[model samples]
Target: MFCASLADVFDNSVDLAWRADLWALVRDTPHLDWLVLTKRIGNVSAMLPADWGCGYGNVWLGISVVSQDEADRDIPKLLCLPAAVRWLSLEPLLGSVSLQSATGPFGETLDWAVVGGESGPHARPMKAEWVHDLRAQCGTLAIAFFFKQWGGHENGK
Candidate 1:
């Protein structure tokens, strides 16, 4: 699995490999049967190739929409990617977000979604309503949803 930042590079820090690295790795060796993308919201402005990482059925690209703000910004980018399977990562759900408000690119390409609350010190809050809305949206769109864990401080209790 590749983290979001690894896929999109900005600010001219040229040490890491490009998105094609994923494609190359997968093409060279399809040993990777499952891949999960993390923190995808961090890459709103970066340029990704049209083929985008890997299109193999075994790979899954997921974007983390931490809040409504991230949902608006990053979801579009993730939707536009050429990956075969696209998904959303709503971990650390801090604020309200609506899949109904999502645009065409998002509503169409998304294949799955995961929802969960924040955890650890200074953990943020998540309303059950928010998760319900996300779940409803996923169901409406026929997308799969996964809820990880609520924040350890509040919801976990």
Candidate 2:
């Protein structure tokens, strides 16, 4: 959904797939602040309002990067946007992923990177090395990096 309505609360467990159904409504709404972008593999900006350039309060743009392969494809696309704040939703992190060599025109627009492990009955184990890699990258790039959790029995603190 777009950042013009506060109707949606993000819950990874939700099975709803991303689409253009909520685009028009967000464009018409003025009280929206956050936009949570998620999907298998597609362009989220393509469904947004053409006039929704950027500089809106709390208007965040994020995309799910499940693996290194998806990261290669999604992060670049997300970076190309003109959103006020851009972020990565690395949930259900299945394997090691890094953007060290994926530089491009859009890479410079990145503002935040969130790293987290899968939760629930099928929770997967996350290696500390992977988290460290992201932390190092974010530090080097001056981007915000947040560790959501460690999943399983490991405390993320």
Candidate 3:
């Protein structure tokens, strides 16, 4: 959790041997729970180690989503994979999103979701109503909701 927050381990841009060494580190670090959050989630299945029988016990797989389009396109793929836990990050929320269609074709839903606005001089603004709506939806669906922040240009707004 304390390591690279923005670097996706499944990224194919990196060297295979480097990825292997990283996975090896994750495998050997039995005391730490590794959270691999990525936007390149489509490459996840191919990036997994051969020994990932049913996925590692300490690893959590999550996808980054900025809007409904990404969520709709990625969540289904995420559900098909095996993992200790699955989640979504709505950080730097760019637009409103509805999770109603994000469920399984049957009725499955995600395990966790995080919501936060953008921050920085160049950051775009977000609506508080959007975050509230997401919280309500998570409540109704029993998905864990972690409200990270109400971002602004300065301070933790």
Candidate 4:
């Protein structure tokens, strides 16, 4: 399940009570694996549930990274946290990102990487080479790579 697809679950503006309620719902639904993607990776440590000692077994935590700068800044933060699965959502990819140097605690690498281009009337162009490069990097690292789309189109490349 993609939790809070249109909203940031870790957004500072969201009410704490509402977040608690969402956590409760997550706890109740043990059979479903929740994929929580957030741009505010920094807020996660403080907002997680009390029982999130090593993260929930059913939760796959991910962060949305658009450029190399954001990747450098946020990926490390996400890596520091404990999650059943750590992944990246490179949607609306505006720049090239090389994950060759990104390593997590205990020499861990990202479990998954979803790559896609911007889509919409004013969607920016995504270079095919960029996608190819990322795919190759993920392959070399043995991380699961999912090519979601090429810019200006809905179908995967």
Candidate 5:
């Protein structure tokens, strides 16, 4: 399950005591693979719990890569951090991104990538070729790819 869905867990505004409580729960729930996505990838090292040796087996870290500039800047940071699974989320995909495709512990570039267009009244449209290109890149590097949506004002079953 995703924690801090509406707020950033890395936000300094959140009390340290509260985060400690959450970490305690995360430690107890070994059966759940906590998928944590953050825009604050830079804050991870300093904020990590003392028990986070190398990385936690149950936690998967994902970072946002909205555009080429961000991908270039953030992907490298993620590469240095150890995790069971390191993924990229190109959601609300703004433009074509040259991920350049790096690798994981076992040589997989990305454990997975989730691609999706923006969704809202003024949602921006995304191109099929963009998705195709990202999928191709992942395929070439042996990374898993998941297409979340074409996206629109309406989201229904």
Candidate 6:
């Protein structure tokens, strides 16, 4: 399940009690694997539940990155957290990104990468080379790569 798809679970504006309630819901639903994607990677370490030691088994924590700068700044933070699965959402990929430099405790501990171009009315064009390079990097690193869609007025390659 995609947890908080329209809103960020780690956003500072979110009420503490509400976040607790959400954590309770997540704890109760052990059968479902929750994919929690957030752009606020820096806020996660402090906002996580008190009992989130080594992270929950059913939770897959992911960080969203649109370019190399964001990736470089956030991937390391995401890798530091102990999650059952650590992944990246490269949606609206605005520029080329090289993940080869992102090393963590267990080397590059990223388990998966969901890549795609920008979408919507004002979406910018995503170069085919950028996507291909990312895919190749993921292949070399043994990270699962998923190509979601090509952005901007068109679909597919």
Question: Per-candidate TM vs. native?
Answer: 0.73, 0.72, 0.89, 0.94, 0.90, 0.95
lDDT of 5: 0.80
* Span of 10 residues, lowest total lDDT, candidate 1: 7-16
Q: Which candidate should be chosen as best, given lDDT against the real structure?
A: 6
lDDT of 4 by residue, 53-139 (tens): 999999999999999999999988988998999999999888789895569767766989999898889888888878888999998
List candidate 6 segments past 4 Å from native: 106-108, 153-157
- Model 6 vs. true fold: TM: 0.95
Q: Tell me which residue pairs clash in candidate 2.
A: 4-32, 5-32
Off by over 4 Å in 3: 105-108, 153-157
User: Judged by TM-score relative to the true structure, which candidate is superior, 3 or 5?
Assistant: 5
Against the reference, the lDDT scores of all candidates come to 0.66, 0.66, 0.82, 0.90, 0.80, 0.91
Choose 1 or 4, whichever is better by lDDT. Answer: 4
Give the CA lDDT, 0 to 100, for residue 157 in model 3. Answer: 32
TM-score, prediction 4? 0.94
> Among all windows of ten consecutive residues in candidate 2, which has the lowest summed lDDT?
3-12
- Which runs in model 4 stand beyond 4 Å of their true positions? 153-157
Give lDDT: candidate 3, residue 89: 90
Which pairs of residues clash in candidate 4, taking residues 3 or more apart in a chain or in different chains? none
Q: Where is model 4 poorest over a 10-residue stretch in terms of lDDT?
A: 148-157
In model 5, which range of ten residues has the least summed lDDT?
101-110
What is the C-alpha lDDT profile of model 5 across 15-86, one tens digit per residue? Answer: 898878877888899899888888898998777788888678888888978888888888888877877788
lDDT of 4 at 38: 98
Name the regions of candidate 2 deviating beyond 4 angstroms. 1-32, 54-57, 101-103, 155-157
Q: 2 or 5: which has the higher TM-score?
A: 5
Q: Name every residue pair that clashes in candidate 6.
A: none
TM-score result, candidate 3: 0.89
Backbone collision tally, model 5: 0
